[model samples]
Target: MTVALMWEARAVAGKGEELLTWATHQPLDPPPLRRETFRAPEDRVLVITWWEGTYDTEGLPELPEPGEDLVRRAVHRWRFETVADGV
Candidate 1:
């Protein structure tokens, strides 16, 4: 099964583009199979990465957090088992 890691952050006022730029450039160890990023109203950035492994396995690197100066609040993260893909 494929596991997906979701990360989200809200940038400080007027810094949404900077936040998105930072997220787009982040490097993942053992690179993920796929990654996508999104921006929402209110300076929120969301990143989702798909890996070819399960959550129980060892050696899964944790997602890195953005610099403290770039965000208004703490980053949020979640993991999920992909149930379906491509419609």
Candidate 2:
């Protein structure tokens, strides 16, 4: 099964762009099958990475936290199993 890892953070005031840039540059140890990034309202940035394996069952790599100065609040993360794919 494919696992999807989601990482999200809210940037401080006008640091949205900076945070997004930082996220895009993050280096994955083993690397993911794919990665996508999105910018939401209220200075939020979301990053989702797709990998092959079950969550926790396999030794999947974890994303590192960004500098405290860039974010307004604590980072949020979630792991999910893929049920279906349309494309």
Candidate 3:
């Protein structure tokens, strides 16, 4: 099965660029099948990583949260499995 992990965060004030840089550099041991990063208005940063595994797979690699000073609130994360219809 294929799993996609989504991580999103909002940076503090004018630290959008810093947060972007930080998010892109996070390392996943053994790495994911695919990874992507994005930014939006309100200094929000989003990262999605795809891996080959089940949702309950143990020890799945995930990006850790950034330092408190860099973000205004806790990060958001979600996991999804590929749909049968491939949507």
Name the top TM-score candidate.
3
Q: Candidates ranked by lDDT, best first? A: 3, 2, 1
Off by over 4 Å in 3: 85-87
Kindly report which residue pairs in candidate 1 clash with one another: none
Global lDDT of model 3: 0.93
The Cα error of candidate 1 at residue 32, in Å, is 0.5
**TM-score for each predicted model, relative to the true structure:** 0.88, 0.90, 0.93
lDDT at 58 for candidate 2? 68
Put the candidates in TM-score order, highest first.
3, 2, 1
- lDDT by residue (24-68, candidate 1, tens digit) is 988888788888999999999999988888865556555678888
Each model's Cα RMSD: 1.5, 1.4, 1.2
Candidate of highest lDDT: 3
Better of 1 and 2 by TM-score: 2
The lDDT of each candidate is: 0.87, 0.90, 0.93
lDDT of 3 at 1: 90
